[model samples]
Target chain A: DVKVTQSSRYLVKRTGEKVFLECVQDMDHENMFWYRQDPGLGLRLIYFSYDVKMKEKGDIPEGYSVSREKKERFSLILESASTNQTSMYLCASSSPSEAFFGQGTRLTVV
Target chain B: DQQVKQNSPSLSVQEGRISILNCDYTNSMFDYFLWYKKYPAEGPTFLISISSIKDKNEDGRFTVFLNKSAKHLSLHIVPSQPGDSAVYFCAASDIVSGNQFYFGTGTSLTVIP
Candidate 1:
């Protein structure tokens, strides 16, 4: 089984604060994704990386950036946290077929 | 524009009854479709999937039917259980497009015992 682990289960940050959410996958999958899920908004992609140094912007990448310095780790960075950014963050790793997800991190920005 | 759409925000079904969740997509280029189930505080898990080449796929009590002509798909759960109550999200991917997925909002289903 594949394991995707997030750094935090819950977090609270003040407005304008910078936040980092880390995700690591034990499996050596080539693809990793970052998504934010909101009520009635479902899962919106933030960023995705196909290789250690290759990154692609998803539909909703505003106020966010990503790093994939290594094959097993992907990080989401919020330059300036805002209330609108408060939502559930999910990380997933996959090959060409199915993807496995992390437990998720609930971020609250006041 | 939202390529994938799940119009029903919620659905209710009695125990042992059938639960049907619908999803529609506007993009004809989508070649692969997937359904995910999500519980509170948990990330969405893969439920089932169907490729454009097939119209239906069944696993136990869960069945997924796809209509390529209509650009729609539906998930049917038989003998619905309380454990089945959760949010179901529909997603589509264009295999030619690096398998990039476009997800619908989601539909929350509640099973009443």
Candidate 2:
């Protein structure tokens, strides 16, 4: 089955620490996205990569960055973890039809 | 501002009843719209999608209706079961604009048995 796998299901980090969330897709989709889901804000896109090494800022990319070094993997990086950055982060890869998501990584920055 | 909006935060329905989740978007350039179902602690999964060319699309128990003129879309679940209870999200994207997909706030649906 086609799959998008997230490296960690849950994480807790100290404030000011650099954090990394890894995602990999076996479907070879060209489009990969990173989003954080908050209560009332829903899923706000942080960053996305359309091709290897090509990234674009999304609606809420201020506190996050992404790396797409290889075709099957996309990584979300938090330069410095903060309490406000604690949220459910989701990774997705898409083709022309639809997007497939990873199980998600719930990160807690304290 | 949120380009896509799901006004309802939550909805409850009895078993074997119809459940309707609504979404509206401000972008007219969006040519593809989709619905996703998410359970607690899980990533949202693709449910159904409707292209701008078609007004409606059905897949078994789920159907998505799109009205381009109004920039509105709705998902209908007939005879919703308890297993159907989950958070639903609506998303829209215009391939011409880019590969980015805009999502709504989401509606949490509960189907009581």
Residue B82 Cα positional deviation in candidate 2, in Å, after optimal superposition:
1.0
Model 1 ranges off by over 4 Å: none
Candidate 1 local lDDT, B40-113, one digit each (tens): 99988999999999999999999999999999999999989999999999888877666467789999999999
TM-score list, all predictions: 0.96, 0.97
Q: Which docking band does candidate 1 fall into? A: medium
* Candidate 2 per-residue C-alpha lDDT over B25-98 given as tens digits, one digit per residue, 9 for 90 to 100: 99889999999999989999999999999999999999999999999999999989999999999999996665
Local distance difference test scores for all models: 0.93, 0.94
As for candidate 1, its clashing pairs are none
**DockQ, Cα level, model 2:** 0.76
Off by over 4 Å in 2: none
Give DockQ for candidates 1 onward, in order.
0.72, 0.76
Candidate 1 local distance difference test against the native: 0.93
Q: lDDT per residue, candidate 2, A1-110, as tens digits? A: 99999999999999999999999999989999999999878899999999999999988898788999999999999999999999999999998768899999999999
The prediction achieving the highest lDDT against the true structure is 2
DockQ-based class of model 2: medium
lDDT of 2 at A40: 76
